[model samples]
Target chain A: MAIRYPNGRSYVGREPNKKPNRQKELTYSNRGMTLEEDLNETNLYYLEKAIAVIHKKPTPVQIVQVDYPKRSAAVIKEAYFKQASTTDYNGVYRGRYIDFEAKETKNKTSFPLSNFHAHQIEHMRQVLKQDGIAFVILRFSLTDEIYLLDALHLLYFYNQKDETRKSIRKSDIEKIGHSIKIGYHPRIDYLHIVDAVYFSDKL
Target chain B: MAIRYPNGRSYVGREPNKKPNRQKELTYSNRGMTLEEDLNETNLYYLEKAIAVIHKKPTPVQIVQVDYPKRSAAVIKEAYFKQASTTDYNGVYRGRYIDFEAKETKNKTSFPLSNFHAHQIEHMRQVLKQDGIAFVILRFSLTDEIYLLDALHLLYFYNQKDETRKSIRKSDIEKIGHSIKIGYHPRIDYLHIVDAVYFSDKL
Candidate 1:
């Protein structure tokens, strides 16, 4: 018998003598999920477990024309994407304001500073000055390694970019940042790193 | 001769003999600005002064089709608005997470409970559980009175709508909520109220 998955893909029942390849399935599980998808799943897990209240802001768009057809919902005819002025995700966790941006880089040797905009850097500075937790989640796609780098270190490298290397070397990230191991339930478990880095004493 | 404003409106020079009506201008200044506009201006003021980092999230939209022209930017051809799963505005303030939804009503006797959706109420509940500062900004257009009602009070009235009244009476709001005076600089100086309500010890 054949069964259809929720995604509408048909799957044939496993053959009586065939063994499931668990290792291959585990490896392929992380293949299609992007960093955004991982973070979204992780954030949803956080929210459902009553652990945190982080959310990604919607993509900004400039709407130019809309048509309100009779007895139908309004449809946008023309719109353009607008640049975001702040980081992607933010929320409250453990009585603290949490703010961070997530980016995936295919480059293995280093994470380029150009991945960040000057205004985003400036926004992080303001968040830090206001005593909120600020950081970035950097993921290297080739190795599937993820690191949480503090905004302070990111700002340092960004400000002195013209004088120094354009990107933060991978070695520096491994030394200064905390690695996040992807898991099944949450995908990217970052709040554990937050608890260690920001609320260690309380813990 | 006519001088054009940055908004593209052309204005003729004032008559030499005519006297400027400062009172009328002051009264009309608040006429054109909506509640969202006032909040946006106020949030910008807070951001520029390094006081807080608050922003109104962009409207959520579901893009269905996009067309990328040969030598131009991508244009969204078809899209529809999506219901927001959270409050419209959220950010950090003085090391605490701040979240709120703003609404303006022309009704004078009461603010309707229908102004809030179930998911928004649920979102506020989650934020409160996480120890974040959550509230709603209510603007009564008839009297031009603005009040910051705590989420606890809002949730109480919202949850008890069937047994009690369908709306929160203006009298109840005036007694429980904090009034924010309209100002010239920030337009709506809400942080002072925040200081009094949430950070009284530090203040």
Candidate 2:
């Protein structure tokens, strides 16, 4: 039997290839949520509860052509998604500037440094230099473990990246990074870890 | 006589309508640049000078459909520009979180409150609560004058908006707001005014 597709007509006896099981694993673990979606939901929960105000910046795009059919709406006809020069998220929390990049990897042993762009590292370095709280939120999808690793420690490994392995070991992360306990309400309550790690003097 | 248009067919009688003298006036004043353009150029200048790190967040768009014709590029087939809940620009300045909205008006007498959305006012209020430096850069387009109005004064007016006038008078802005000197480089050096107004203690 042949199945028809939306964009074309189908011939008899030709079966569409079934894709690999990308959905099954994610459906089984972490309630089928990506780290970015989870963080967005968590940020919303925080915002609603008035606990903190943080937002993921929108994906940058280079708009080429736009058609304004009406005064109110603009239709982007030609646009390309551009690489962001800065981190994914930034906002003010507890009167302190909070800046961080979030990344998720399936690797069990180490977080690959390839996940970060050099510009992001430079941005974090600049933030740290200005006394702003800068860090990386690393999520191990295999273990569902999340860690907030300060930029200073990340910089140390980044500078020695040429000589050393291009990844930070999970053991090192567990030692230097602060583990955020996953919760029900705000799934990943990272601010608790931020308080303990960055504002330890006040705490 | 016939005129050939770029889109093709030649027209015999229809004369191309000339747009009003809007372009002429702008060309004569401030080198024909709008306030937003001026600020964006100023931001780039500041970034190049290593004076402060500030960036206008990309306009948020709700992408409904995208086509992946090739592996390298994705074409946005259908998208709508989304209303941003937060202010237009934000970043770290002197280790302080700077959050502000910039607006320009052709009105010479007053700046209308309608230029700002309710959510933007709320966002600024939240920033203020968290001790972030929150303000608005109001530009009187006709006079080519800009003023940095603090969030405190904004909040006061916002709270009494229902009972008060819908617009803030130019005299009021000049009295309560710090005037930013238009400059050759970094066209609107509002940060200089910020240092004077907010960080006066440090100065």
Candidate 3:
């Protein structure tokens, strides 16, 4: 099957020529789920375990028209998805304000800057300015690898976009980002990495 | 005009028995707008001024049906509002995680406990436990009075429901809550009250 993004990109679950690793795949359940779903499940697990209070903000929608045939339920006859003014997930985590955006790319070599919007970058900068923990969760679906990249590095690369390549190379991400180890109960344990990066004892 | 709450209460703009006081009425411009709208406007003002990064989370909706006749447009045929798992507004302000819900009541004497839900109270408790600043912005629509009551005080009052009344009285709110002065640009300056209550230098 294929997973579709909000921007209308359809992602096939399998690579074009690579054979499925049956033995390794059996270890992880819900490998078919998208990165967003995996993160939501992780957040729910954290919530239930009283570890964090993160939540994904609902997709912003602009209602153009509505039909009220009866008094009880009004139907939205016309609506469009609006460009979000801020990132998706935000909450309080261990006495710190945590804000982040999750994006998945099938490209094995690089994560495109085009995946982010100007407003979202600005919002992340504002969160960082307020001393909140801000970062982006990058998932390379082809390799089934996830990394937590701090917003400061993202802003640095974004500012150099005009003069450099339009994307961050995999090598750069591997050097600067913290790899999130995938787990069974909480699939993407990004918060563990967050603690190491933002709340480490050295700080 | 009638302002309908999510809980199905209707709030009329005018009180029938009271004669309109022209001079006092001219003080407030958007006297007819709902409390939610007023708060939203205030948040925008704060954002533009770069004073705070607060926003009302979008209303969650379960989309049951949709029709996509064209490639560029999608029309929602049926949808229902979902009970939010967290508070309405949340963001980082001055390096602190801020979370709160805004509610209004037409009742002149007290704010009803029924205006809130068990899940919302639970969410607030979790935010507070995590050391995030949590509160409820109460608007007495009939009297045009606004107060910022901390979640600690609210939880105390909520637990004493069996011994006390089912609502928090005006006198009690005035005693425990900080009154928010209305302004032309920001309208309800609730953050000013938040600073006084939670971040006072003397404390």
Task: Specify the highest-DockQ model's number.
Answer: 1
Clashing pairs in 3: none
Winner on DockQ between 1 and 3 is 1
DockQ preference between candidates 2 and 3, better one: 3
lDDT rank, highest first? Answer: 1, 3, 2
TM-score of each: 0.88, 0.84, 0.85
DockQ of each: 0.76, 0.46, 0.49
Give every candidate's TM-score on chain A.
0.86, 0.83, 0.85
Q: Is candidate 2 or candidate 3 better by TM-score?
A: 3
lDDT score, candidate 3, position B102: 92
Instruction: Rank the candidate models, highest DockQ first.
Output: 1, 3, 2
- Compose the digit string of candidate 2's lDDT tens values, residues B1-203: 67898979887553543333555544425467888899999988877776777788898988887778866799887788888989988888888898999999999899888888888998898888878999999988877888999988987776666656788989999999999888778789999999899889987
Candidate 1, residues A46-107: lDDT per residue as tens digits?
Answer: 99999999999999999999999999999999999988999999999999999999998999
Clashing pairs in 1: none
User: For every model in order, what is the iRMS?
Assistant: 0.5, 1.3, 1.5
* Model 3 docking tier (incorrect/acceptable/medium/high): acceptable
Q: Write one digit per residue (lDDT tens) for candidate 1, span B31-119.
A: 66788999999999999999999999999999999999999999999999999999999999999999999998989989999899999
Candidate 1 local Cα displacement, residue A94, angstroms: 0.4
